[model samples]
Target: MSDNYAASFSINQPGRDAGILPVNQPGRDTSTSEQSHTEPSANGGSTVSTRENVRPGVSYLAGRLEFEPSIASKLDALITEFRDGKSTKGNTVFEAYDFVNSFPGGTPETRKFALSEFLSTIDSVEILADAARRCGDRAQIGLNHADTTATPRIEYTANAPNDNALIQAASQIGSKRARSEALSDADVGPGRENDMDYRSGEKRAKLTTADLPWHSEALAARQDGRVSCQATQDLLYRYERDPGWVRRQVIISGVAPPTIPPGEWDAIFRGTPVNLDAVFSSVHHVLPPKEDVGRVGSTEIRFSNPEPSKRIQTANDWTTAWDDVSEATAIAFPHRARELKEYGSYIRSEFSAKMPSSHRKIILYDIAIRNFVQGGQRHLLTDFHLFSRFHSAIVAPDGVVSGSGSGTKPGSSSRGRAGGRKIDGSKSEVCHRFNDVGRTCPFSTASCRYIHSCKGCGSTGHGQRDCVQSGRDSRSTS
Candidate 1:
């Protein structure tokens, strides 16, 4: 009999579906034994069982938690009240619903909804007859039913916390400082790289070197044939000392020379040069001291406060003050070149320390002038002192300088004007004035009756507008 039973239990592939019993076989009874289903467990064990009908449970719990409640306390209270007195073991169908609710998962609202759903749908809870305790002396308070109707009427929710909220909460705990302010308070003492301002200052100084006004003036003067070696040295010295005076004397009048090259005949016919030293001496016995003629970083000079006598005490105070002015000016340029007006507004807001308006204007002008020069616009030097005024003057592409007031005189290179003189050999003229080569005269009307003399010339001038003699020479007698 044991051998027959062994033959019936034939081994097959693990997890293979149960095969149907054969209907007929040679010399065998067809319908003597009952058919059974065998299922393999993960531990290589197999269990034989018959099928039973089951009902599926509906999902109720979903979403986030809002309120906090003690699940352990509720579970203990339900277990104690719903138990039989004999062994304190046994729970009612309603107690099973409470047990499921007390189990962890889902928001407060979701759990309450699930409990209501379970109480309404569940008909009865049965403690199974085959239910047995494997371990002795162990306290078991819940229902001992093994199957519970072969399926659960209410499902337990698998709730997970929001990942984004968890990540955000983690990030907020230990934030870092901005990179610009990375220098620690310890690293910044009285003047030791204080608040990383030193880094910024160092960068500004390097940048200022490339765009200094004095450097621009030097290059322009060098191209226009004005600067000498000794003049350059004196210029540098003055820039290091009194930059304000250099501006008063020179860069304000630095206009670019004409771009076109003169023809050989045009050059030869111009003229002999005049003795300017003698002429200047005759005009004024004492020459204005040969001044520094560059503005390269000279915009840094801050004028001293108006003294009763209009002078400063020690040279040291003056030098220190000028250095401060230059440093501030350098900070504002090239970096803020495009947004100069905005930068000026920012400066006003930051200067609660009450900086002089003149100093602020000086720095702003430095930025503006550099921007103009870089944009390929010519700087038309106008006399600020003569006008005692404040205004911007437009320079035409043709190099005509026009302004609002009469006090602003555009310099001529002919009659010892602030721009100095250029000799023209074309018309036997000792003086060649600064003329816009192709520009119309700003003063001329359609018909002029005034004695129209050429600039710096007593003779009928070279151009058609002024030289009536040349006009007559060109006329035919026929």
Candidate 2:
């Protein structure tokens, strides 16, 4: 099965039909917004959107649990605090419902325990704060967890020790040793075969080739006039910090590029003109010591040799097999020819790695030439991630993903394409149907997860319907 980021962990993909908004991978970026829905009605009574919007009580936080009248009263109080708890716990209270709903479901007894434990935890430790960061970063436990139901009657999941995922994730933040810590000289050289920082420098530095500030500086120098020495220096420094990232980006950024004449590759990829060291990698291993030059069965006797042996080298030092990645980049993005000319040699090596040159050549060439979708929609380079486990997902002649391919579902890409009110919440993509034309989505509020915006400007506050920008139709944009 393809172990895409979310599927790699056994956690289910949480939906947000639960009267709450959604957050991206809320483990790192803690930004979230709180919103309430109310609409002017056709008959003047008023129309309401968003599901399960029951205010358990008037949102009065009592001095204690006050559960004698019924669990319902207690529930109302909790939900009240939860929904209106913004600014109480700082980040988490800001997240409100999403933070509470992130908990997985459990049995009645376990759930009951979960309810009290959750409240107790909230009343005590800073679990909420950490959880908000975790949700923003990883474990996208949006809203509709399999274990929870509507509020008042709402429940939290507690399946014994196995279910404190967000809690565990919260505790783990800033806990790992920074990648730059304690590396011997030999460990800091070129080639990044083992590094795997998916955040791409959004968080830690294991796979970050350089600090964001340095990238900012580099970006300022990204123009055509940047000197060759500067580019070399940048690439080398990135290699020194996170050699694997440079290589990874090389493979990642170029895929299924627009086709061209087959022979066009010959100029840059063929023969020995392009160096192997620029594309492939090598490993140096010290062999075991050899015995003295005397046969064991012969009359001559020899003692075991203890001297150190020579270090053998295995290298993918030559090949005319694959297209020259630099040339490919130059051809694909002609506008960036200057940048490619500067950084292409060091950057393009990522695609080759340790794989056989012939395989590399055949594979790259085959994918490049193949028809993409079922109806022949061409594959764009951005649509492909070569290193993802999902890359081999079976697709029919049409663009549809095959159900038979484990972990690769049809149209999986569209589920979160735009952000969500259902899944991404207030961070959802704008609702152009409502904003641009004063028409709500055909699928109503809960079913349609887009932002509610001013009809004219598509922004909040009194934006003009006439203010809607031209050529920016969110309804048909995707």
Candidate 3:
């Protein structure tokens, strides 16, 4: 503290130490002197001073320094005196800025920090503009300046304005006097405003669907069945074919059903009721024989013709055509499972009717497989090869085709039990003769001589309890 300010302020010369001049020191300029300095010459010949003009306490090399008290201390003294009514007027931002500029010899870094503090503490824009003109880097200093910088930095303090305070500020911005007043005085704290409360679009409230007058009319139309969901769906369908017509019917009229063409009315209403009889007939190709078809539950056998065109037909001619082609294909290729798309295409070609969707075809396939399994536990056919052969044999007028993948064709009575014998833990010389019939081992030399084989793939290397391939094979065999 022993003249640290003076020692810090003076630049290093040849011999003269930067001496401390105490406030009480007599015969020395202490009233904030500027312009020139009388110092003993470096060569000790006479008093020397800088030719370039130097401000009060600042010079090019040495920055401004504390005298008896620092600039901060002096500002604090002025503030306290003004608060106590000892000064002629209140401490204003202009006064604080003037006090800072008076000391023109301070370091650039020190001056910036001091100027930032003054700008932050003062609320007046005029004072801030003046400071910006005098400062070296106006943008840099302005960015760091904040009204709360004067407050002591501490832990866990809210430093932004809250929502209520911001609302109050926006409300008061209309008045000049209110704009001039401090945000803190307007009860605005120094914390951020919650974004949820500060939406920046048109200030008017948003309207919901229920707020529209037409909403009630639309609801009434629907409740009275004057506006059918089917009609709306038909409009969507027509949108794919004739978009302009659909737009006139739907968009122009606000989806009113009366806007639709008269030609489309009968089809829309007729398509609403599903033709379950035709659906059952198209899917019947996959069902078990007549006696075993009853085991399939009605709930498990759900089918729907997603295509609107098919649902419009009343003659059930499409089902009869599909049955003929499917039965013909089964008889000709008894060793192959029928392809859904191929069967669908043939029906469309012969009858010139649009086929059901792939989704509907898949549903039909699922129903067939499920019913085939539901016929009997021993009669389950999981292999595609066996399923095709068994289907062809059933539909074949002459007993020409059989359900065997190899020689020694099993008869119709034995065909159902063939799948059972494969999994029934019984051994036969024909099954054991090849030695590789059911062995799952990677090596071809591995043999299956045991009585028990896997219920899944008929493999003998692993039992059903430990087999991994068993479950996978069960899903795709038939």
Using TM-score, rank the candidates from best to worst: 2, 3, 1
Residue 123 of model 3: what lDDT?
26
Q: Write the residue-wise lDDT of candidate 3 on 1-478 in tens digits.
A: 2213223332123334444432332222344433422333234322212222433332212222223345545655544343333453324444655776577564433433344333333222222322333232232343245223433321111222232432333333323333232121111111212222222222254343355778676556545542223244333333333333433453244433221222222222222212323333434334321211122642222132233222212114445433443343222223323343444553344333312211222233333443453312122223354455433443222323322211222542332122455332112212332223343443222122223345445564544444476555332333
- The candidate maximizing TM-score is 2
Candidate 1 Cα outliers beyond 4 Å, as residue runs? 1-185, 189-413, 416-466, 469-471, 474-478
Estimate the lDDT of model 2: 0.32
- The whole-model lDDT of each prediction reads 0.28, 0.32, 0.33
**Residue 297 deviation, candidate 1, in Å?**
30
Worst 10 residues of 2 by lDDT: 1-10
Clashes of each: 12, 23, 14
RMSD each, Å: 30.4, 36.6, 28.8
Q: What TM-score does each of the candidates earn? A: 0.14, 0.21, 0.16
User: Which candidate has the highest lDDT of all?
Assistant: 3
